[model samples]
Target: MLQYQTIPVTPFQQNCSLVWCDQTRSAAVIDPGGDLPRILAEVKRLDLKLEQIWLTHAHIDHAGGTAELARQLSLPIIGPHKGDQFWIDGLAQQGKMFGFPHAEVFTPTRWLVDGDTVTIGNSTLQVRHCPGHTPGHVVFYSAEAKRAFVGDVLFAGSIGRTDFPQGDHDALIASIRERLWPMGSDTVFVPGHGPESTFGRERRSNPYVADGV
Candidate 1:
């Protein structure tokens, strides 16, 4: 079975997941917003090799500490290409605007596309491009685990805000309904923030989904 642990990092409380295969001890770090020390500690505690760092989107809170973590672990960074390249390139500016102590932009070693698969050890995480919160937003789905790491595109009882630059309300809504909802009703959703939820639960209870449904 695949083992998963979530470390809530940075001021945004982004959920950074450390997923590993028990047999191979190979792991992927998902959305390392910050707290490099804690991430490293978990890697050590789990006795796993950090193979790659994956980003759900390029927002400051999601990609801010990627550079430092990659440098320390010497792991490749991977992310979808559709979202805010401008935001990824100008992370420092976004950090300054938000009053963060420091922020640095780190280019991904690989740009993900729809249908791409990220493999670590015995598992594969399929990339689903669900653009709405940001133009290039994506979710990582592990079919075997019946889980999806949905970035800012979704939340517990709500969806991501579309007030940011390049954010589109209609597009966001459509993406969630078309791309995410079809994943499976029982898939567990590990969002960018807040508590975990299921696609089935969100589809029925989320106001955004209710409006769309």
Candidate 2:
């Protein structure tokens, strides 16, 4: 079975997830934004054999600690597609702007695409390029677990801000309608900065992309 725990990091309280295969005890940390001590403590408590670092996007709040964390863990960093390279390059500037710790730019060990697959232990996750919140934003979905880790895309009741660089409101909506909806209504998703919710719940009540709203 696959298990995950959400560790809220940074002042933004972004959801950094530790997803692992229970059988193998192999794990990956998704979006280690900040609060490295807290994140590391959690990993220690879980006794998880950390393998790689996964990212959904490159926002300061979602990726601020990625470079440092990867360095400490000596783990591979992956994802967010290559389109987010600009954001990655501006990590230092983004940190200064956001009053966060000095963040360093980095290159992922592997750049993800729409159809990429990520393996953790014996579990595999499908990657969907759901650009909008950011040009290279991606969502990690596990069909076997009926769960997805979505960053700055669809929120509990509201959607991501499309005012940032390369944000596209139309593309966000289409990604939700075309790419995410097909994953099934029962799919539970963990967003970057809020509580988790099911596609069914969001589709029925989300003001931004509700099926009826």
Candidate 3:
């Protein structure tokens, strides 16, 4: 079975998730935005072997600690998408602008594309290309767990802002209605910030992408 714990990190309160395979006790950190000590402490407390760093996007608030974390653990970095290469490259600038710790840029061990799958131990999650907030944003869906880790893509009552360098409001809406809706309304999502919510609730209540809107 797949199990996860969400840790809020950085001043932005980005939700960094620690997902692991209960059977193997192997783990992966998704979106280590910052505060390495807190993240590492949780990993230690759980007594799980950290295998990799998974990214949903390269935004500073979502990927600020990726480089340092990967280097320290010698773990491979994965996901987000090749489209976010530029964002990854500008980690330093983004950190400075956001008043975050200096973030170093590093190449992903594997750049994900739509339909690709990522694993943490025996658990596998399907990846969906969900660009809107960023040109390369992606979502991780675990069908078995009925859970999705959607970074800055959709929120509890709002949607991702398409005001960044390559943000597209139309594309964001399309990605939500087309790509996300198909995942089923029962699927619970962990957003980049704030509390978790199910697609069913968001579909009915989210002002920006609700069913009628």
Best by lDDT: 3
Give the lDDT of residue 141 in candidate 3. Answer: 94
RMSD versus native structure for model 2: 1.0
Please provide TM-scores, in order, for all candidate models, with all chains considered together.
0.95, 0.98, 0.98
TM-score, candidate 1, is 0.95
lDDT of 2: 0.93
Total backbone collisions for each predicted model:
2, 0, 0
Task: Give residue 192's lDDT in candidate 3 (0 to 100).
Answer: 92
Greater lDDT among 2 and 3 belongs to 3
Please identify model 2 stretches exceeding 4 Å from their true place.
none
How good is model 2 by TM-score?
0.98
lDDT of every predicted structure (CA atoms): 0.86, 0.93, 0.94
Give me the runs in candidate 3 sitting further than 4 Å from their true place. none
**Candidate 2 lDDT score at position 48:** 91
Residues 1-213, model 2: lDDT tens digits? 779999999999999999999999999999999998998898899999999999999999999999998888798999989989999999999999989999989889999999899999999999999999999999999999999999988989988899999999999999899888899999999998889999889989998899952
130-179, model 3: which lDDT tens digit per residue?
98899999999999999999999999999999998999999999999999
Give the per-residue lDDT digits (tens) of candidate 1, residues 1-213. 567898998888889999887779899999887788888999899889889898888887788888888887799999956456887888898888887658777778998888898888998888988887888888899888999999899999999989998889999899888888888889998999999999888877887786433
lDDT of 1: 0.86
